[model samples]
Target: MSKWTEIRDGMVSALDVSDVVESAKDQLITDLTGDGMDALSTVADKFITQVQVQAESEQGWCMVRDKFVLPLMINGILWAVKLVLAKSTPATATQPEAPTGDSQQ
Candidate 1:
């Protein structure tokens, strides 16, 4: 998935975070009802829009992208190192045969 999508999904799904957002919206509505119920809705809508805008910004995208891409890059580096070590060591030298001492004579 793209970085922004990952971030958006994370925000929507993890840690009861959406509840917090909803709670904040509810609080705003309660506090700002003097401007009328319609104004409260508009404020809530604007808040959501601003969150989306921030998530899609370059810095947010890069942070989310690194969360995924960094692990894959580390795995690739580890695999390459293992491959090089395996190639350097002879198989026979590494896996020694069991001793069959000449007791069968």
Candidate 2:
């Protein structure tokens, strides 16, 4: 077999062994702690809820902005201004019409 083939096989074997070792470690931890999957799941749930609440609070515009309405109005006006500018800008002039000529004599 080629050296390359041998190397590929060795890498695959190593990955398989690593996976087994990690699985065993997780099982050992679960068994020793007795917290098992249920405890882990509850912690995960609380973490998710806290993250959601924090995200919502942070995203509340009124809390951060003194004049939230003004900012939204300004944004709308800017968007409209951009749209008008884009519409008024002339497009590149069309290519000059090709001369009318019969291709086949």
lDDT score, residue 4, model 1?
Answer: 100
Per candidate, the number of residue pairs that clash is 0, 0
TM-score of each: 0.33, 0.26
lDDT of 1: 0.56
* Candidate 1 residue lDDT tens string, 1-105: 899999998977876744566556555544443354345446545654555455565476665554445445555655565555555444554578988897786
How far does residue 12 in candidate 1 sit from its true spot (Å)? 65
Q: Candidate 2 has what TM-score?
A: 0.26
- Each model's lDDT: 0.56, 0.54
Q: Model 2 over residues 1-105: C-alpha lDDT tens digits?
A: 999999999999878854566556545554533444345446545654555455545656643342344445545655565555444433332246676887767
